[model samples]
Target: MAKDRFHPSSRGLSHHGMLPLFSHHPVVSEFHWDHSVWGSSWLFLIVSVLGYVISVQIVKMLLSFRRRPVPLGPIPALYNFGLLVASVVMFAGCLQSTMAEIAETRWLWQRSKTPFEWIICFPMGTRPAGRVFFWSYIFYLSKFYEFTGTFILLFQKQNLSSGHVIRNAMVVIMCFLWLQFAQSLQIFVLLSSTGLYITMYVYLSLCRMGYAPHFENALRYCQIAQYVSLLLASIVLIGLHYYKEGCSGMGAWLFGAFLDLSSLPFILVVNKQKKQRHVFNNTQKGSITSKTE
Candidate 1:
């Protein structure tokens, strides 16, 4: 009954696209979320990079002489909690859109019906846009807010790792590219990333509360897992692109390719560093044990 109620031809909501709950905004009609000039790809790239550079420099200078870490009483925890809540919302919204589109079909590895149809790709026009695209915009904006972490790290007197900067810059640029090209794979990206973030932030919040802090290693593994998933998914999409005539934003494939290539090495290096640290610690412990004996 619930399924039938939402059948695209339902009486009350049939006229408008998408579920009645999300029809109010007319995301497909009212707003051109991916407009040019004001929403151009170049603009997003330039602004995002400039913003990141300026923010990082300012924060670095502010913390230059401060030896002691700035005590951020509850801000980090609260901020992460807020981000966790938003990510959960994005995941749920994207899931609903995917379900609505596919109906009873398999949600994952689902086959395409038409020459241009695929689980990820939507039609050319935005009319009756689904919940997935709507949430993609939300996710794009959320990237800007993520830069706050740079400020937090600086204040905490932590080194700003290259991986962190590259990841943030890539996401910002990629999100902009998606908006420009109307990339379909973003739904998957959004869901997977947001899900990981929820797990990560929850663990972080717990650690902040003086809970199981040793699991930080697990979080690092999870972060690497995310990049691996991203790399694999990009490869899959490259294959899927050939299956159809083509999809909107297919040009963004180049961006996706570069991002995947760039991020993977960084993640692998981090993983390697962690392994080396662990081995060094064990060796030191053994040497001390022998000396004591």
Candidate 2:
């Protein structure tokens, strides 16, 4: 049973405050990703992605005739703020739970290896039912909630704001695989991503409030830097997977790599679109200066 794997440690809590995160939570511990769950199927993935695309297309068609954006009235900012809180909590919980797992498990094997090594390469035979994995599961489920951001953007005629169907679906796929296989490298990726998300949600919220809209370029630049860094980490994991005692869920990681790589071009394209926000900001600044003069 899943309960057997997560019985509390005999030793006192390794990390002071983090013990409760994965320790005694019945929902977190007993969770499984098989047919027992609602969102655990290929059909769900296909239907969700297609459903979102179709709905967006319908809205776009309707709006083409009516052709005016609805005033969202603080909704967008609140949405971003909500996601910001989620990201922060996820990041902190995952980080703490992950460190606890490593601390507890390191002595069992490869006692000399650093925790960073484990992040890229989980020990073989790692199961999907542990404390660390609970966070991954939460991350997977969170994707559905995130779909709201896209729709909010859609209704306002900015549907592509920070999310779109392809990107959202890909996230669902990758996160699903991470939990399904208890894949190595996902923790690192998830942890790093939440950091980026914190920045992004803050940036988007400010923009929605009609402030710092011009700083999107800076956010994109940060994302590109993270992409490059994670890409390098992927290469390292691939190398370790081949050379060392194999890492758990590496096969899933391979599939995830393909999906992750596919996004590169999309990221590049969006970065290039620029939308002249930078130029528009500078022009506005000049106009204000002239009027003041």
Candidate 3:
């Protein structure tokens, strides 16, 4: 048997002596996704996204007349640090919940004919709420919070997140469906991005604070590795979905996989070009120093 019935473990953050994000509370337990819930409807999602996109473009157009970037004192640094902390909490909560889910289901894996299949495949009728999904809901809400990052960038010279409205909307949609259909592997993807978000934003915060060790190359490599790793996982999920019976939310998962496939090439090419530019800049500096010597 490659499947087992689903039931979540009863545990909380108090069990780990950490933050209260893991507690058994009404907010998480009473939580349920539905069309009736706020931001759950297609119209709401479209309007929210379009509102952000239009608002941001309007601000940019208005800001273009200004000669210089606005200086918001320490706001950007504070913002990065704040997200750094939130990323830690999110990463911890999601990871803790994910491990709990997997561990609770370990017995099924042990008896399954396809052991690995169970990791990415949940049996039918699994409830879409619990500790993990609680944290997942927090993550879903955080998408809206992150939209502010682009607006924050509006004060800057060349930050590029302003162009990511569609991308952000897709993420919000994917995460919504993840909760809506109780998709398998969503935790895995969430963990990957949250982990990488911490890493990238840690570096960003440090750079903002005048830190010495800024390994741009290493960071770029890490970013690329995450995309590649998730892409591989997506491929594996696709294979398991068709061959190993089925996984919940395969339709939604396919969209996510296609999104990854489409984006990976662009990132690879962009990183390559960035690396070349970095190398060229360093070489030019070295030649200038040599001539001075």
Q: TM-scores for all candidates?
A: 0.76, 0.83, 0.82
Ten-residue stretch with the least lDDT total in model 2? 1-10
- In model 2, the runs with Cα more than 4 Å from the true position are 1-8, 12-24, 159-163, 209-214, 275-293
- Candidate 3 per-residue lDDT over residues 1-293, each given as its tens digit: 22233343344333454434543455654466676666777787778878888888898888889878888888888888878888898888776665555555555556553434554565445556666677777888889888888878887755454326667767888888888878877877878888988998988977877785658788888888988787777778877777766677877787887777766676677677777889999999999999999
lDDT of 1 at 90: 78
Winner on lDDT between 1 and 2 is 2
What would the per-residue lDDT of candidate 2 be over residues 23-71, giving only the tens digit for each residue? 3466754555676777778788779877877776777677766567778
TM-score of 2: 0.83
Best by TM-score: 2
Name the Cα RMSD for model 1. Answer: 5.7
Higher-TM-score candidate among 1 and 3? 3
Model 1 — which ten-residue stretch has the worst lDDT? 1-10
Cα deviation of 128, candidate 1, in Å: 11
Query: Of 2 and 3, which scores higher on lDDT?
Result: 2
Ranking by lDDT: 2, 3, 1
